[model samples]
Each structure stands twice: as C-alpha cells, then as structure tokens.
Target: MGIRLSSVILIAASVGLLSNCSGIRLRQPLRSTEYDWRLFGGSETRTNAAPQFLEPPLKLVWSYDASAGFGPSALSAKDSVLFIATLQGELQVISIKDGERLGWVSLGSAIASAPVVDGTTVIVATADEKNNVISYDFSSARKYWKRTAGPVESAPLSVGRLIIIATLNGTLLALDRDTGEERWSIQVSQPIRSSPASDGERVFFGCDDGAVRGVNAITGNLLWTARTGAAVFANPIVIDSLVIVGSLDSTVYAFHVQSGEIAWKYRTSGMVYAPAAGFEHRAVVGTAHGDLLCLDTRTGRLLWSALGGDAGGVINAAPLIVGNIVYVGTLDKQLYALELSDGALRWQTELPGRMKTSPAVFGKRLFIPVENRIVLCYRSTSGEE
Candidate 1:
C-alpha cells in the first residue's frame, strides 16, 4: 500500500497550521449578552445549522491576534463572550462585540478541540496526562474540577446536565456538569475522531471502524450502528430525522435518527473531512476536493455542486448555514458564502493564512479563525455589532 495524494496533502497542511494562544487583556467593548453558540455545534441538537440569517456584503469588524495554533473545530459563543483554544491548551476569552480579549486561562498541555461554554462554566478537553478534562467557572476565575480521562480530540457536547466526551480510544464518556463525575461510559473498541452529536434523545458519532454509532446520551446504552466504507473523521450533523455523516471513503451517509437505518448515501469526488450543515431538508457541505455541494436530505439527490478556490484546496472545516447563506472556510486561505438555494457563490474573500476550522455566527456577526492564529469577526455592512 502506498500513501495517497490526499494523505500527503493533509499532512503538509497540518504542518503549516499549528500554533497556540496566550496573554490576555480586558476590554471595554459591548458584549453579545446572549448565549448563542455554547457548544461545538450550532444548536443543542448538534445540527450545525444556524437559526439566524446573514446576508452577504459583509464588512470586517475586527481581528484579534491570538498568536497560537488551533485545531480543526468550530468556535463557541455564549453570554456575550467567544471562547477559543489553542493546541497548547490556552483558552482565550474574547468579547464578541469588539473582538477584544477578555482574559486567558491555561487549561492543559494541549487542547485538541473547541471549548464548551455553559453560562460561566467552560468544559474543555485536553491532551494532559493527569487532567484530560477540566470544568472551570469563568465568573470567579476558579477551577471547579478536573478528571483524567484519556486523549480527547473532539470537543465536548453539552447534553442536559451532562457533558459528553468522545476519546481517541473509542470510549464515550459523559460527565456531570456540576461535579465532573462520570455520568455514563461505554467502550466501543474503536478510535472516535468524530465529535458526538445529539438529536435530543440519542448521541451519534463516527468511529474509526468504518461505522456510525448511536447511543443513548443519558444511559450510554448502544442503540444501533451503521456501517460505512471508511473511517469517519468529520462530525455528524443531526438534521430533521436523519443523522448525516461523511467518511474518508468519499461518501456521505444519512442514517435514520431513531432506528439507525440507512436513509440515503451520496458519493463525492474526494474524501469528506468536512461535516454537513443543513437546514430543514437541504444539506450543504464541502468536500476535500474543494467542491461545495447541497444535497436533498430526503432522497440523497445532488441539488447543486460548485467547485471553487485554487486547485480544490482540501476542506476540513464544517459548513455553516445561516439563513440564505452557507459559509465555508477552506485550507486554501479562502472563505466563501454561497446561496443556499442553488449553490451559487455570493461572496468570497482570502484570509491571511490557510483555514482549517469552521465558522460560527452569533446574531448577525460571523466569527472565523484563520491559520490557527488569528480570529476574524465580520458582519453585514448594514448590520450593527
């Protein structure tokens, strides 16, 4: 067996973006005040769908220098503050209104994913040997509890009073939000690179064993599992009654949320490292070949596909659906906003460096991290911050 061209490209891209952020300052900017995006996914269900719409012709509001490297994950917004973590385990808090640094807290040796913000409490997973998971209260700047799980590469999903964490060792564990104790645990015996998503009842994630598994979030009981052609590295999106997931085999599978039956599957030109961000029956996603596609969730039909950027820069970040717009950031240093109805390109811009993470929209403001070092905020030219 030989290394594939995609693997070579991914390795090169990863080496280019790996920095951490530290140092902080308090700012006198207005805050979002709303806890819009507290989890890695957009909603409580981990749908990756935005409730509000952001039209194009957006203006750059501000950009903050984090001076650190970031992972391939989405940003979390809550309570007028935005939280981002670096590979070096520095969690930097920024004010959403002005892109000002609120403060900084070093949580672990390395943070592999985004931090989950619940009110003043932040739950983050790290590569620390002693404290892989930590829950801290930001209001008083005090550490609440820390637990040594394992290497957790995915962001923790907040479900009710439990914080769901999937580890590289294939152990799905849920922690109590208040005490950091184990709520439930299950061993699937496979690596879990994909973050867990919920449909209010069951939690779904992709496994390295070429399968997508759904378990009860509260009980940790395995409900059902569906097979794929390759390992699933992208996060699963729960849309409508379907659990949409993409695989390294260049195929996307939609499983019935309740029974785990195959609903529909579609093949792309390249691998699917990016997850789907869907609205209602329409699913918008990006492929590793730099193709942006919109698929019919009910029938697996391709509504439209548009390939953009330079030489199809491999896309690893998840797509964000905001009203009539679908925003995606690619590793080719390009950010795009397309029309959700027809896959028409609406707006495009180049970043300072390659972007491997996804975008988050709170109210009318859009937040995207570029090259794992800088955080950029944008809004409609007519919209106020």
Candidate 2:
C-alpha cells in the first residue's frame, strides 16, 4: 500500500496531530549525527545505552496518540522526526519537537518492529509475510525496494550497506541497503525471536536452541556458538570484548566475542525475555519475575540486584541506560529509574497502560512507547538540554 498522507494542524499551545492518516507528505529530512535513539537497541551493540543526561523533575513535553498498539520493537528518532510502527500495519512519522503526525504509510497488515532510518529511506520488516522487508524512500514518496525475507518479528539491523533481519523461520537475511539484494544469509534451524546485534566485526543473536551464536558480519560465516540452559530470547550486548545475553532459564551468560568461550553465567530471579543494556562498564537486565540486575560487563559479577519490590512487574522490554540512570518499564504500567552504580531507586512514574517497548532518548528527553497506542515524551524541565 502507498502512503496516505496527512497534515499537521495548529492547535492551542501544542500542535494537534490526530490519527486521520492525512493527505500531505511531510518533508523528508536527512539523517543526522545528533540522533541517539535511531535503532532498536540504539546501536548495533544492542546495548540500549546512551551518553545523554537528563535530570529528574521532567515534565511531559508532548504526547501523540497513534491509535494502534505497538510490538516489542522501539521508538526510533532520526534528525527532526520519529519513526514508529503500529501493529495495525502502518509506519508513522511524528514531530519530535511537538508530538504531531507528520505522515504515515502502510507497511503491512502486521508489524512487530520499528522502522530503521537509512538516510531518506525507512527500512521496515513486516511479520505479515507478504511484504516481508521493504525500504521505502519518503524523500521521493516511493518504495526504494521490497523483498520477501520471512515473517520477521524483530527490527532490521543496518550494518553499513547491509540490512540484517531474523525470520521466525530461523533464516537471517542480509540484504543490500541500497538495492535490497541479498548480500549474505544464515540458517540456525531454530526460531529466532531475538534481534540481531553487532560489534562492527561480528554479529550476535540468541535462538530457541538455547544457544548464543556469533557470526561474521561481513561474510555471514559462523564464528562460535555458546550453549545455555534454556531458550535465548534476549538479544546479546557486546561490550568490553564480551557478548552478554540472558536465557529463559533465568541465567545471564557472557561469552568472549571472538572465541565464544563462556566468561561467566549468573542466574536471575526469573526467566529473561528482554535484551541487556550497558553504559560504561555495568550491564543491566530485567526479568519476567520483576528482577532488575546490574553486573560487571567484564567479570559478570553481580554489582546489585533489584528484586520484586517496587520494580514488581513482568519486564518484556530492555532497560534503557541513559547517563547514570537505568530506566526500566514493566507490563504493570510503571516506569522505574534505578541508579546504575548501586541499584538505588531514584524514582518510578505511574503510567496509564502497560509499557512493553523499551524507552528511547535523544538528549534530555525520554520517549516511551506505551502499549495503549500512544507515545509519551518527557523532557527535563531543569534546563539540562
């Protein structure tokens, strides 16, 4: 389906951008180096870590009602706009300054991931299987290329000129970012609910086989595979030459990126579903049983663990590491911020609905994709921007 554009209207103190799916294409801005939340886990490392800082006492900057539920993907920010995909099958663009609908186009009947911005084109993969993967160029108001990879439930990882994605059928396809041609492919022969992560030289992911495998990003050659106790649904994070991930068996496994040797494995309170996040040297992860753990990235030593007290809720999304704060959201509709050094509870915000998608940030603002079909933006009112 082509785009059904819309117009942004001036309303009150804030802009009014409702869910009409209007009829005017907005300006397609170029990719900016200032974007810190442009990908699923923010970067190819799948760390969900940002160097930005924002003091508390944040006020709600703006909120945009998308009128559709979101999947396990994230909210991506590129330049002046934001890209989000709804389960109702539309890729929407919104104003970051003020939550206004810039435009939207039908990506498929179902989408479980966010759109990855590649310059003027937005790369998105649909779980609907018909339009499996598509690169739509909003600058020209047309599709750059389309291909059927598989029923992909994760966001496509852009590695330079290649677009990488994982199919539920266990096939990982690496396509040319410019022409949508196949560059490389890998078959794990098991369901890959976890998305792909990279450390420039190699790519990493988890599988249903309870194995965390590392593959060369350039040649698609299998590097090494490390076994775990149960299925590995969380994406692995590469930091300090170690690939760290969590397994459904409630264990966090860390392996050497090159040798695939087990560095360490620490058990959690419950099974892990979301990916792990890291900032400087500490990596944080949440569990289905409402456990938030911070570990040393190099040694896998437990720095501190936040059990099911105030952070009690099933965490389906990864914790975001912004500056020294660990922002965690749960299915129980609460957003908790923990101090990264000691796991001290800084504060928790009450929301209207469940938050299953990971939070993203630019500089001083926080963008959260609440499951109630709305995106809430909060910025520091203390002039930290």
Whose lDDT is greatest here? 2
- Estimate, for each residue in 128-236, the C-alpha lDDT of model 2 and write its tens digit: 6666798877655566798988898877898888889998999987899999989899998799988888898888889999998999998999999889999988888
**Cα deviation of 125, candidate 1, in Å:** 0.6
- Candidate 2 collision pairs: 5-22, 5-23, 6-22, 6-23
What TM-score, over all chains together, does every model reach? 0.90, 0.92
lDDT of 1: 0.79
TM-score of candidate 1 on Cα atoms, chains taken together: 0.90
List lDDT for all candidates, in order.
Answer: 0.79, 0.81
lDDT of 1 by residue, 111-180 (tens): 8788887755778899765678988665445667889778888888888898899988788998999999
- Which runs in model 2 stand beyond 4 Å of their true positions? 1-28, 307-311
Candidate 2, after superposition: displacement of residue 330 in Å?
1.3
**TM-score attained by model 2:** 0.92
